[model samples]
Target: MLRIHFTDADLASTRMARAPDALWEVAASLHRFQTRAGRWAYAGWYRTTHARLREQRLDRIVREVLLPLFPRARYFPDFLTPDQSSCADEGLDAALDAIVSTPSGRVGRELALLHGYVRVPAWVRRLTGRQERRDLVAAIRSYHEVAVRPFADQIHARLEAGRSSSCRELLDGGVQGMLAGLGPGMRWQHPVLQVRYPVDRDLHLGGRGIRLVPSYFCWGSPVSLADPGLPPVLIYPLLHEPIAAAPASPLTALLGRTRTTVLRVAASGAGATTGEIARAVGISPSSVSKHTGVLRGAGLLISSRHGGNVLHTLTPAGASMLRTDT
Candidate 1:
């Protein structure tokens, strides 16, 4: 069993040295979901949507990653099915055609794991709070040690056989190989994908993964803790929906005037406090909360507290609305 130790210095370096300048943001976003109610809601919401882009991401990643072995794939889904119910039947139908015409379950299983990993139901978000996270950490850590290490070995072997010679080279090459193959639908740019093991990691459920894989292929999918290399594993890159959310109601459309105000306040590169937002939007703190609540319910705004102040920010959706309006 291996343990990945982190010194305060090491963590600080990692935080400062995050690649793509985006990991910091992702880490913060995830931190927000660690709260009590936040985690519960996230756990419930992620399951409903993780497959939104799996079809699309898988189509691309699978075709690219395994295409060298098989080339008959065509008509792959343009987007993965995070929540099959959320997708249009037209795209879903085309996906089936491509799926049926494609090769058998072996390759399908590997690629499909990513989709299943993404569909982990935001269980990590369910930790009661710091105490639960601490209580669960030991089990999770053990699983990570035993489960992910084997997959890392497999990945390393694949990398060495696939390319360059050093340990760093192997890590980089393997990660690049996997990420490169993530396709257009990969939601997160720098997902922490790997195999994990958890004591309760489901055995009977679909793709009871012990492997830990993360990607921004779908920003909506929550971060999960599991080892994917173990039994009942699923393969396939599942990306989130393309995020082309359009509110049918005029009030819902164009970020609504109320939402627009809240988002604008949050934009100045600094998140807005409820008090600040209320003053900016000319409403009571309660009213500011009402509007923000609407935006949050829509997944367009996210709230956090910095020091003594509660802060609000336009999520990707809210940011997009502001940008699109301009």
Candidate 2:
């Protein structure tokens, strides 16, 4: 179990990443290749990514350089997923720059720690040299471009939906409520947030707070930095459901134009409230509610009540329909 000790100030400062962390996504996507545990959840992604890697002739690099460095073990070097990479504005290029500029001494220390858990290739020792680190970064960028970038839209949609749900949770019950609803593997027990982990540990966030990063590729247990002193972060898996292969023709056809517009508005960023949908669709609030109720009944949308307002977001089935329609 990993117990994260939080203070009152820590709770006050807690926040969620506005967008997916690119480097963390790279690490988590690599993890997907290493295991078959949640293969069904990512079957479509797995098939496409695998084919793309082979087609791009990047499979060798993934197998030789990337896989060894990012093993699905207890630890991987913290330098690989830098704190700067978590910024919403800074993207893959900035993240790669951070990896290349990481202090050699810190890199060496983390590499040594990785060696403690698993055998690292002798070539991995060459990472101490600036040129070698640059080479590694180049390979990482290639791997991400081929394997991770192609699925950017799906990833963004899933993240937006999750962020909407989280925001509603925060408004409805504050940070603690948001924490409680993070995932099944996590439990919020007052000062400490207990998480099911491979090894037992405790992280004390002394008012620095922690960033809750929702990852599309991360599965099973939540991941955190090995060292306790780094700006705290917890990358947890998003719930994955198989998207339907067929288009949602019947549902959309039955709803006609206004209801269809409401569904589209609800599918927009972070979801929409009844008022937001009404304004966007130019319909009355009662009409918006009637439309959403029918969609919700069909499992096309999910509505959560937050005091007087209700937030509505698309289910996976609904998202699939939008994808097909577009």
The candidate that achieves the highest TM-score relative to the unseen native structure: 2
**RMSD in Å for model 1:** 20.9
| Candidate 2's TM-score | 0.80
lDDT of 2 by residue, 1-326 (tens): 99999999999999999888999999999999999999998898899989999999999999999999999999999999988887777677788888889999998999999999999899998898889989999999999888778777667766766787788789898999999988779999998999999999989999999999999899999999998989999999987654432244564566676767777767755687787676655678899889899999988899999798898989999888777763
Q: Tell me how many clashing residue pairs each candidate has.
A: 47, 0
Candidate 2: Cα lDDT at 36: 100
Candidate 1: tens digits of C-alpha lDDT, residues 1-326: 11222233322322111111121122222232233433432342334323422533433332233222221121111112111211223332343233333334432443344344343223323232445334433332332233232233222222222121122332565433433343332222222322222222322223222222222221332222133232221122123221222355343464566666566666643366777666545678898888888888998889877587677777897777667652
Q: Rate residue 229 of model 1 by lDDT.
A: 30
Report the Cα lDDT for candidate 2.
0.86
Weakest ten-residue segment in model 2 by summed lDDT: 242-251
TM-score of 1: 0.24
lDDT score for residue 135 of model 1: 41
